[model samples]
Target: MITALSHPFFLHALLAGTAIALASGLVGYFLVLRAQTFTGDTLGHVAFTGAMAALAGGYDLRLGLFAATIGVALLLGALGRRGRPDDVVIGTLFSWILGLGTFFLTLYTTHRSSTQGNAGITVLFGSIYGLDATQTTTAVLIAAGITTAVLLLARPLLFASLDEAVAAARGVPATALGLGFLALAGACAAEVTQAVGSLLLLGLLAAPAGTAIRLTDRPYRALGLSAALAVLDLWAGLALSAQVPVLPPSFSIMAVTATCYAAAHLVGP
Candidate 1:
């Protein structure tokens, strides 16, 4: 264990995974609070399509990832009532995004797969263990930005999420807040996509938040607990995978997350 901790790759995964988990926890709290888990799910697919498009276009994957998710998020906000997307909007975008993902996947496989075969797989299942020092730093920075943004928005977002009607009546910028929150969720989705992959990103976002919500009635306490649990799950999963060579990090992290969530339900009222 100590020897594994000394390895540069493991260190990179630790740093990057911690950042991703923290941001996912913070942003995810409101996602569950707002009943916007479907939006997060949609953004996950959006991230995959975006990365594939970027790879096919020979550009940075981050560009496509951030752009596609954030853009669609804003669109959902704009089209939905009170900036909260309805089932129709989410379902519509979800289908379209999946189709676009297939198109980009085909393009990528035919034209760009020779140059970068595992890139697509990495976006699907993540490459946290493969992150270099620079990638780790970038992940940390992005996650920090997301954490800060979520913290700043927490108060108003909570108000809007819990009671948009009363919040708006009380002069809260519910529409704008909804737009901003969705964008942040989009960013969080994109960031987690790099750490846990687009396929499993929703689990990283939803599970910790859900567990915290189940465990506590207090919103603020639940928020903090969600972040703590997310970090713990990520760290434990990483450590478990480090110890067990055959276990994939993503699977390990989510396994811990699911277990925590199940325990919370069993314990909570």
Candidate 2:
């Protein structure tokens, strides 16, 4: 297993995937507890359009996605809506970004001569074998940052997640917590989107967390289970992608993750 982490391509794939699994599981634990899954879904979809624009501009796609997601998150956090429907806000933002993406895609398609075949499909669905060492290192660093945040802010974050009213009453600063978490969520999605792509990103992030929740009511145990399951799913996906010809790696990972989720639902008590 460790040997696979040495081959140039496999090395990057393994590092990036495991790092993403850790980041997503850790951040997603809070996202799930706060019922911000919709926000995550929207931000990830926004990342797709951001990536497409980045490809067109000859910019680093991951950087572009991260910038866009961070911007969106700040905007949402700054709004700090009072008694408003959060879903509506997220949906509205998602529609605008996706529409912009569709327009850009049309331009890319019309320019055909300048477009690469790797544009939409490879980026949208992902190609795990394509990650390089630099990208893997970046993923590791970002995951480490997220993990540090979890360790440093766990008590307050969990307090805000479970009972914002009480936490705020106790001087927890729920608003600050929400804003901080928004930043964290954007950062998490940006890293994961680089490898899995926007389409399958949510599945990889949400499934493991969802499954972990099904397995245990205890938050810490659920987080550990989520990280473990997510790593297993990613490794299984990489192995399958290697063994199977003409099959995409994202499908393999997601399929295994889906199976895990279904099993959790069936066998969990």
Candidate 3:
């Protein structure tokens, strides 16, 4: 395990995964509080479509993933200002994005040669081992920005999440705060997609936070627990993957996360 840390790829994975886990844990607390796990899951699919579209257009995949997910988050927020998001609206957007994803995948396949075939798979399942120093730096910067934004908005956001009517009565910008948080969540989802892939990102984003909330009613303690558990999940997963070279790190990470969540349900307060 110690020897694995000496390898460059493992180091990059460690740094990138840690950054991603921290941001995800923080944002995920509010995501569950706001009852937006479905929104986060939807964004993952949107990310897949966006990445495929980018690949088809020969553009950087992150640009498309972030742009599309953030754009949709804003749209969802704008449409749901008066109340909770309508299931019909979410379903519509979900269908539209899935259709677009299929179209983009088809287009990419038609235009690109066999050498580019793995791009879609990479987008779907992630390619964390392929991350370089530059990408790791970018992930860290993005995570820092998101975490800072979350902290700055923590009190007001918490107020809004727990009781929106009261928050609004108290002059909190509930709508703006909600929108801002969703946008930040979208960015977090995009960054996480690079590590855990779009399909499995919900586990990384939600599991640790969910477990923490189950174990603790105090908000601050829950936040701390969430971040801690997320880091543990990431590190343990990486260590397992190192031991079993045949297995993918993302799979290992998600497995650990799921296991933790299950255990929390059984043993947590």
lDDT values, one for every candidate: 0.91, 0.81, 0.91
| TM-scores for every predicted model | 0.96, 0.92, 0.97
Better of 1 and 2 by TM-score: 1
The candidate scoring highest on TM-score is 3
For candidate 2, give the lDDT: 0.81
Q: Tens digit of lDDT per residue, candidate 1, span 1-269?
A: 79998999999999999998999999999999998898899999999999999988989998999998999888888888655457886898789888988898889888865765677788989878888898889889999999999999899889888998999999999989988998998999999998889999999999999999998889999999999999999999998898888999999999999999998889889
Local lDDT at 215 for model 3? 94
Question: Taking the tens digit of each residue's C-alpha lDDT, what string does model 3 give over 52-136?
Answer: 9988898988999999889888888888875656877898888899899989988898888665678889999998888999999
Output the lDDT of residue 125, model 3: 94
Q: Candidate 3: deviation at residue 250, Å?
A: 0.8
Q: For model 3, what is the error of residue 237's alpha carbon versus the real structure, in angstroms, after optimal superposition?
A: 0.6
Count clashing residue pairs per candidate. Answer: 0, 0, 0
Work out how many backbone clashes candidate 1 has: 0
Worst 10 residues of 1 by lDDT: 81-90
Q: What lDDT is reached at residue 21 by model 3?
A: 91
Q: What is the lDDT of candidate 3?
A: 0.91
